[model samples]
Target: MTVIVGASAAGLACAEALRRKGYTGPLTLVGAESHLPYDRPPLSKQVLSGDWEPARARLRSAEALSALDATLVLGDPAVHLDVPERAVHTASGRILKADNIVLATGLRPLTLAGQPTLRTVDDALTLRKRLLGCTNAVVVGDGVLGAEIAATARRMGVAVTLAGPQSAPMALQLGPRVASELASLHAAQGVSLRLGAAVTEVSEDGVLLETGEVLPADVVVVAFGSAPATDWLQDSGLTLGNGIVCDSRLRAAEGIYACGDVARWHHETLGRMVRLENRTNATEQGIAVAANILGADEAFLPVPYFWTDQFSAKIHVHGFVSPDATVVEGSASEGRFVVRYHRDGAVTGVLGWNMPKQARQHRAEISLRCPAGVAASTPGAA
Candidate 1:
């Protein structure tokens, strides 16, 4: 029997990939949420913006999932893992034993007490309802999720104030130059940026900053970041650090594999352990893990890719962004361009600002010049 934990994108992808790869063994998928598997990236954009209904985010139709011939254990969270016996103890007193166990338990969003954070469908729906009725909202984070939420709420006719410690949104990920462009984009959309200051608390009236300033808002959304959902596996006898530590094949231990946002596996090209928390990584890693479980013996190496849509901007990024970036195609003033990021005079990343085609073309440059897994903080050569 093959049991996959965490029935979201990664877990579901693993199950599907297993069947596609001709795994006819007994399969089971377990999920903490009662709802069927759904895509999470839409929660901050399409779903929150009312562009997509909640059901529209479902990854697979009911008929499609049923055809997989897998048992789905829903609404029961895994509480413990018996590594020796390969047993998963669930909250509902069900001990699921399987020969091969895949851990896709994903990550849990970090939020201030009583503040809203987008991670699941319910969270998005609740925030959407509040956004519709609220006059002003303060998003407390400068990362991808916060920026997306702020943009969605602003389009919904609610005044939004984005608060964070960085000078510009996504500074850490997009670097200073690209983040400056993003700041301009958000400001142009009439979203206030209360950045470069740490948020201390979310009070009844507003958000309290460490700079002794309070940004008043009717609702507060925390999107700073998240940690792996590995609390349930504390005593599972698996090596855990930033996430569930795995080998290059994403194997946590014998007969056990980890994937999605919860797997911190070694990248041979980067020569380091890395954990990616993005939608693309989730699906790709799931497929890779499935193949490895079937004795593919292939290293899980991939150039990370992620996209963000805020207002009129459609940004696509391949690999990591550094503070050192040069516009390679079109001009930044034109609002459509491809920028290449360099660290120590070598290309490490590429960014597309409304120029997805050009950005994709430049992606070839990364593959030819940089080593595999250059996206994970590893330096690339020109």
Candidate 2:
């Protein structure tokens, strides 16, 4: 028997991959949420903008999932993991025994008290309703999630005020130059920028800044960040840091594995362990974990990649970058640029804004670990 926990993208992908890999074992998928596995990326963009209905976010149709021959135990959160007995106890006091277990429990949105944070379907629906009725919105935290919300709000004809602790939007992720360009882009769209500011309080009407200024807002959206949903695994005796620590094979402990946002797996390419909360990572890691469980001697060493759509711009990133890394090419002014992070004359990461083809090509080249010195030769090589 194979039991999978958390029926989100990672878990569902794992189950489907197992079937595709010809695993004919008894499969049981447990999910805390009642809804089926859905694509979350669209929730912040299309669903929030009313361009895509919430029901359309389902990654697998109910019939499709049923065809996979997996029993889905929805709306029941796992309460305990009995490692010695190789069984999981749910909130309803149901004990499920399995030969192998995969923990695909994803992350939960980090929220500030008195502020709205988007993560689940309900949260997105509530936010969409508020945004549709509001004329002005104040967005705190200028990360990808925050930027998406602000962009969608502006498109809905709502005045937007984007605030962040960095000097500009996405400064922590994209660096100062790109962040400045993003700020300019938002400004050109009539979105107000409150850079280098911290929110002291979140009120019903607006946000109170540390500078003793209050900004009136019809809606306040908080997209500060997310943390892995590993609180239930505290007694499972698995290594836990920022997330569940797994080895290069995505194995947490004996006969137990983890993937997706909850798994902090080691990346042989970067010589470090990373916990990426992106759909690509989740899907790839899910397949990798499934292979390892089925007795395949494969090491999951994938080049990290992620993408976000904000207004009219589509930003894609590949590889892990560091603060000290240099951007070898491309500029943010043209909106279509590739920023390369180089370490010792080798490309370590690539950030592409509004360059999908280049981003995809870069990701493919990077995943193959192409010749160490050949990254600089690619088109849009940054």
The C-alpha lDDT values of all candidates are: 0.88, 0.80
Instruction: Kindly list the per-residue Cα lDDT of model 1 for residues 1-382, writing each as its tens digit.
Output: 9999999999999999999999999999999999999999999999999999999999999999999999999999999999999999999999999999999999888869878889999999999999999888999999888999999999999999999999999877677888899999999999999999999988886999999999999999999888899999999999998899999999999999999989999877766787887888899999998999888999888777888899988988888776678998998789898999876566777999999998988887664244332343221111
Per-residue CA lDDT of model 2 for 1-382, tens digit only, reads 9999989899988999999999999999999999988988998888888898889999988889889999999999998998877899999999999989999988877788767888888788999999888878999988878888888889888899998787887765665656677888899998998878788898775789899888898889999777888899899888888888888899988889998888887767645666777788789888998999999957787766777787667877777443444444455656687776655555666777887777666654343343232122111111
Q: Which candidate is the best by TM-score?
A: 1
CA error at residue 113 for candidate 2, angstroms: 1.9
Against the true structure, what is each candidate's TM-score? Answer: 0.96, 0.91
TM-score of 1: 0.96
Model 1 misplacement above 4 A: 367-382
Number of the top lDDT candidate? 1
